[model samples]
Target chain A: MTSLPALPTPKKLGLVIDLDVCVGCHACVVNCKEWNTGGYGAALSDQDPYGADVSGAWLNRIHTFEVVPQGGEIVGEAGEARIVHFPKSCLHCEDAPCVTVCPTGASYKRADDGIVLVDEDMCIGCGLCAWACPYGAREMDLAAGVMKKCTLCIDRIYNETIAEIDRQPACVRTCPANARHFGDLADPSSAVSIMVAERGGMDLMPEQGTRPVNKYLPPRARKPLASSTPLPKEDTTGATGFFAWLDDMLDRI
Target chain B: MHPAPSIIIFTTLSGLGYGLAVVLGLGLLDPATLATKIAHVLAIAMIGAGLMSSTLHLGNPQRAWRALSQWRSSWLSREGVMSIVTFVPLLWSAWVCVIESRYLALPGLAGSVLSLATVFCTAMIYTSLKSVQAWHTPLTPACYLLFAAAGGLVVASLFAFAGGGNASLLAVLAAVALMAAWIAKTAWRRNMLTLVPISTPETATGLGAIGKVRLFERPHVMENYLTHEMGFKIARKHAAKLWGIAVVLGGAVPVVALLVLAIVGQVSSAIAAMFACVALLSHIIGMLTERWLFFAEARHAVMNYYNG
Candidate 1:
């Protein structure tokens, strides 16, 4: 039952995140939890919400990293260090090991749209799917005794009642900086696909060979800052004393 | 990977059980004997206890029967199916041996093959995981098979000594199996230590082009399922100490004990039986520790995202 689709899907609907504009505001993270908690996978339980060690199951998470360009100066008037805001969720991989490792057929990928999902009803909470995931995309809901993961907001994206413009993942709609884009990656002409092509989007851990559908656009290169005023040239003309030379230079300036 | 006690106990006890079943199925011990009957009963008990303990770790133990449906694709499911299927022949063989007081050749052979196959399936459950480099190796199954054989032989030796039949041969077999298990385990540990992680922070983020990357801040201030499940870390010194203990108790002590049985078994059958029991007990404890380390030491590929 956990076997993969015999044929690949035609439409690989996924996400393309732009790291350049992400401000690490965590709007995506917060909104994902909010929507998912009340939405399809309801009540993403938090253990000890007010206690010392707070832990819970969250589908989307953001990680901030400090990436310094190689052989670049440590400190400069122009920005030399880049702080990247990485928002991570399920990529709905074409070769998702998570889906294949499920013992009860709870985890699976849709052949029509290529959206990976978990069927809570069938899940026995063995947690093998989570272990098989290289992206850390799956989370086990201990209270519910089932695994939770990003479903790409299947309820909203395909819902006829929702407005067309709003028919996207909650995280994408909630991103304050408009850093997340959702569309069909299989179509070359799709907006998200075009953006990926233009921005040189890349897969995380290509060696793992999960073939993640989500792509991350690297941060843009920084432009050097131009100084407003040029320094005055030093006048080292014949001056007998230091004080006299300073006075003459000051007068000339 | 947290070393959950349920799984550790399941694998260890079940491995021992299946190993004993395989030995019994091979007609290594006399079928029309009280010692063989005791061994058969012990095997069934160990397997039943192990299978039951495995469900303790499941979130819905009542729904565990559903796990057998995916045997065509999942190793875990195959293990479940195989274990259940193996029990039929195993129980039949035991019944014939204990009740009829004779070995049923066909049923005994079938049970033996199925028992070993079930153990292979158990090993495949971990070996098939691509995300865990430490366990995704040929050595994993080899080690499992060897340890099971070694543990089974030691138990069989004890029964044989108690029954006053071929104690020296069983003891020698146990000794050889123990030595092989130890060598294979040592190799597995060495391989795991030397294996360069295919996944790293740079690869995980796909920003290796940006030079060295370090996490400045995490997504949340609190821990989450990913962190809790995959973030298990064991100190190097503690792991080394456990490794030493496991080798000494599980491998060396059993080997020495079995060797003593082989030498003094004819002269002092009572003393040899006692030594055999000691080896069995020590090996069980040692395997438990080894299984704990097995889980503790494995670094899941998902952990690279958390800088684990």
Candidate 2:
């Protein structure tokens, strides 16, 4: 059961995250924890809640980074600062290391949709699977004594009970900026695939050879560190007689 | 990368246990002697205790039996199977030596081969994990094998001396194995200190195309499982001190004691045996320190994100 499927999954269902639009709000992370706690195998447990040392297992995580161009100041002294929000979850890689390292066959990747999952019933909580993963996606539910990870909302994505519009993964639906996109990545015609192509989506640590299904759209290029052009002057031509008088008085002041 | 006491005990005691078992399997000492019989029993007991210690760290030890089912893909599973399979020949050899009062060549050699193989399987569990850059290498298995052989030779020499067998040659061989293990460990430590990280913040977030990325904020304000488990670090000064101690106790002291026992010409078995016992004790404690350092200094790939 730990061996990867002989044939590639045709669907390759995954997420495409647009870094240009993510607001660092962590809404996707919160909603992911909210939905997965109730929908998946085990409830994500938090230890020492409301205490000085609070810890828990969460399926989704967002890291914020400040990008500074070479030779540019780290702080926004010249307005060159760029902050990027990075949201990460299970990439459901084609050759997931987590699946192959599981001694108990608890961690596996579905051949149909390519979603990596943990069968809680079979997990021995040895934590070898967690050590194998490069993305830090899997978490062990201490209360349940089993590994937990992003199922891509297996309960909701294909459910017939929910409304069609409500059936998408909770994180994607909850993203306020619509930075998260979901679809079958194997199909060129799929919306997510098209977006990836247009945006030149990239993999996280491609050198690790995980071949992650999830792709991240890099943040768009920012303005030069020191712009050669001057700031534009205010347009005074459209001011009416009263507005013009007020503008002229303000300019004089 | 936390140096959990359970794991340290498991690797150290198991390596010594299996090492002693491997030496006994070669029929190096007289099977009729009481010391040889005690040595065989000690090996089995050490292996058993070490295995039980490993299970103590598991969250669900009750379900650990299922871990043996996936040997086709998992090194951990392979280790489980190999360790269990190894017991058949080991027990058989033990029976032949104690109950029958003779060394059975077939079972003894087979058990020796299997015991070393089990140690190799144990090494593979760490070496196969690419996420821990320091552990993923050929040198890992080499270190484990050399140390096991060295530990086995040291203990076997003691039994040989007590059984009035060829103790001098075994003692010299123990010194050589100790040197080999320490030399290999030095190389491994050097490799760990000098390894250039392939994955960095630039590659992790993919925002490096624009510029150098620095972690401004973490997803959770509180300590999460990833941080708690993978974010262990050891002070450079502390690590250096421990390395020095491990070398003295595990390498220099044991090798010198074994060599002295050999040069003393076994004039007094009582004094020589006492020295051998001290050497074995030093080697165990030294190897325990080395194993603790193994876990403490190892930096996991996830630490790249945590800045640990």
On DockQ, the candidate that comes out on top is 2
Clash pairs for candidate 1:
none
Model 2, docking class: high
DockQ of each: 0.68, 0.81
Off by over 4 Å in 1: A71-79, A223-253
**Whole-model lDDT values for every prediction:** 0.88, 0.88
**Residue A81, candidate 1: how far off, in angstroms?**
3.3
How accurate locally is residue B189 in candidate 1, as Cα lDDT from 0 to 100?
98
Tens digits of per-residue lDDT, candidate 1, B1-308, equal 88989999999999999989988988989888899998998998999999999998787677788899888888999999999999998999999988998888888899889988999999999999888999999999999999998888889999898872588898899889989998999999999999999988888887778767778788888777877777888999999999999999999898898887688657566676777888889999999999999999999987776778
